[model samples]
Target: MISVEGILFAAALFCCALATAGYLISLLVRRVALAKISTWILAAGFMLLTLNLLVAAVHWTGWSSFGSRHFLSIYAWVIAGIYLGLQLKTKTRLLGAFIAPFILLFLIAAAGQGADRNLVPSQWQGGLTTLHLVLAIAGEALFVLASAAGAMLLIQNNLLKNKKPGPLGRLLPSLGDLDQINHFGLLWGFPLLTLGMIGGAVYAAFVWGGSWPADPKVVWSFAVWVFYGFLLHQRLAIGWKGSRMAVLSCLGLIVFLLSALGIRFCLATVHNFI
Candidate 1:
């Protein structure tokens, strides 16, 4: 018999899968109406996932049972939630074609992980650690949105440059709107990530003392933070926008993602749970 959590997870996954198909179809066939419908379907999946997480939390005996599965589940949830929230203020519904696949991928990854395995460890479980995870995941979710918007901007720009913006170009969001989403993402994501890192650093000081900074995960995280900061700085101070900023945003996300995979799998680090 399937548990309530399992039922919710399965239901949410189904919704996301259907929504992904809908969004992809909307993009391929230039059906804006279908994309709008897909948005509601994706929203349903997000709500179901929210309930699933709450139910899972009830069984979590402290943070010790919080495994990589839980982490990825929450990560996917944040991404979905943020993307849906942005829809209220931006007309980037078509961009769901880019975003839904990622949400689906994270959920699929979560499904493959050991649900009961401990990821945070006993010694590191606390309010500060929780804050670090939440804030960092939220920040990263925004970055994902920024990259999606940036990616779309690139496609739209390419179509415009070639003077062949077919029906799809008309369906895409305005370049200004895309750039604004990218700006909002960088502006808010940077501060949240910085605060999350500070919390992590404080916790590390208490747990790992002077040697924490030397850890490969810590080092890579700091480097990513620095790179993220530079992108934010360029956007705000240097007045960068349009295709250039869009290109950099896509590049930043790709490099950060690739290096993150390398660090997680290849390096010896205390953050192995993630």
Candidate 2:
């Protein structure tokens, strides 16, 4: 028999799927009504995802729900929550076309991986891990938004360069707005990620008596941080924007994907706790 958590997970998936479909249709059909419907549906999906996480946390430790598989699910939840909040503040419903698919990808991965128990050691559980994870996930969620914006920017750029504001292009957010999202994402995500990495180092020193574990995840994570740091420097100091910024953002997302997922599948690491 399916458990309550399972039911909630299923419902969340269904809602997110519907939201993605609605957003995709909105892009194709050029309809504000459809975009509004998609926004509400996405909001419902985010709420259900939140409930599912809450239920899992209640059954265990609040942070313990972040097992290998379930962690991606939580990441999806974070992305949705962040996107919804940003959508409200920025009123950029058109970003759903790019963002919704990312949520779906994470959700589908979660569904495939199924549920699993968190493997956090007793000695490792506390405020340190919680802070590290929360900050890191929040940072990554912002990167998710940035990547979405970068994608939309590329699409819009292509259409504009061709002097064809096609129906789909017409449905996209303005180039300026998308660039702002990209800029804001980098501006906010960098500091949080830096703090989170520092927190992780501190936690490692406390638990394992060493700061650097030479773990694959840790190494790749550092690389991702450095790459983004360089990107930020270029954007801020060098005033890079337009296609270059968009391309780099897209490339950054690719590196992030490999760092986040590739290490999990391809290499053994001490960071496998999630």
Candidate 3:
């Protein structure tokens, strides 16, 4: 007997998959109308997933819930919220073609993981831990989006610099627009990332008694931090822009994903394996 929640989740997954397919098709045809439709459909799917997350939250308690929510629930919503924000603020419909597939995969993975039924915090790590986690995810989300924007910028820059844009190139935003988005994304994402790292440092000291670098999670976090820090330094000191910034963001995104999302897949993080 399938519960109502299960049915809703299935429907949501279906919708997400459909949206991904539609967006992919849009890449070939470049229909603004279809792109808009895909966006709405993706939003509808995300809404259903949000409902599912709330239902799961009602069923769980303790840090277990928080941990599980981090892996299965919170991250996807954060990314979706980011793309939606990008959609609202800019004429970035082209991103839908690339972004939708990623969302579909994330949501599909989320659905498969199911919600953890008892994730309430079991210790007194302080309110700061909760705040830290929230901040950490926010920063990671920003960086991820910035990275995506960076990749787009690079593609657009390369196509333009060569004086011969390809067919797929037609689907991309102008280099100027991509450059602007990368700049803004980094402008906002970097600060949030810095705060996340600081909050994480505090949490680590309180929890592990200064046993910081030993944890793989912390190691990866620092690795990503260093990468982005270097990017920022180059951007400011070297006057890096356009292609250089785009490439840096591309590398930065790769590091961020492997650390924040991929590390969990290895069963190596406190956030639980999804």
Candidate 4:
């Protein structure tokens, strides 16, 4: 028998899948109305996931019971939330065609994990750790959005460049709006990630002392920070935008994913909780 939590998760996943299909169809068929309906469907999935998380938190007796499953779920939730929030300021509804699949993928990954498993050890559970995770996840989620926008920008640029926009071109967002979304992601994400790293560092100092800096996860995270910092600097200072920035954002995300996977599976670090 499936539990209520399970059912809720399943429903949320189903909603996300439907939203993904709706968004794709909207793009292919050039139907703005379908895109609007897909946005509502994605919003429904977000709400259901919120409820599922609340139920899990109550069942586990605290927010500290987060495992890999919960982490992925929250990650997906943040992505959806941020994207929906961006919709208010930008006409990027069709971009949902690119974003919804990622949400679905994360939810699917969450479904594959054991819901009862707690990734954070008892010793590491506290307010600071929770803050660190939340901030870091939000930052990463923004990066995901930035990459998606960048990907769409590339498509839009190519179509415009070739003078072959056709119906598909009409379905995409403006390059300026897509660039602004990328800018928003980098402008906000970098600082949040930096603060999150600071919080983690403080926690680590109290727990692991000097040796924590040498941990593989810490090293990889710092490298990621520096890479993004450079990207941000280039965007603000060097005035990089359009295709160059778009390509870099997408490539940066790819590198981030590869390095993260390598660190998680092949490394021996104290930060393997998630």
Best by TM-score: 1
Model 1 over residues 79-186: C-alpha lDDT tens digits?
999899989877789989999999999999888887788888788889999999999988888888898999999999999999989898999998889999889888
Judging by TM-score, tell me the better candidate of 1 and 2: 1
Clashing pairs in 1: none
TM-score of each: 0.97, 0.91, 0.85, 0.95
Better of 2 and 3 by TM-score: 2
Tell me the TM-score of model 3: 0.85
Residue 135, model 1, lDDT: 93
Q: For residues 1-274, could you state the per-residue lDDT of candidate 4 as single tens digits?
A: 7989889999999999999999999988899999999999999999999999899888886545677889899999999999999988787899899899989989998989988787888888898998899999899889889999999999999999999998888889989999999999999999998989999999999988777888888898898899899999999999999989999989888888888889889999877755
Candidates in order have lDDT scores of 0.90, 0.85, 0.72, 0.90
Tens-place lDDT digits, model 3, residues 1-274: 6766577677777887888888778877866677788889888887887787677567655566554434545666777778887788788777766666666666677666645444444674457776766677777776767777777777777787888787757777877777777777677767787787787687777777866667777788788878777777777788788888888788877766666666766646554445
lDDT of 2 by residue, 1-274 (tens): 7878888888999999999999888888888678789999999988888888788887875545557556778789888988898888886798987899999998987887647666465568788887888789888888878888998899999999999988878778889999999999898998999999999899898777864667888888898899888889999999999778989988999988877778878888877744
Regions more than 4 Å wrong, model 3: 1-5, 57-60, 67-70, 117-121, 124-126, 259-271
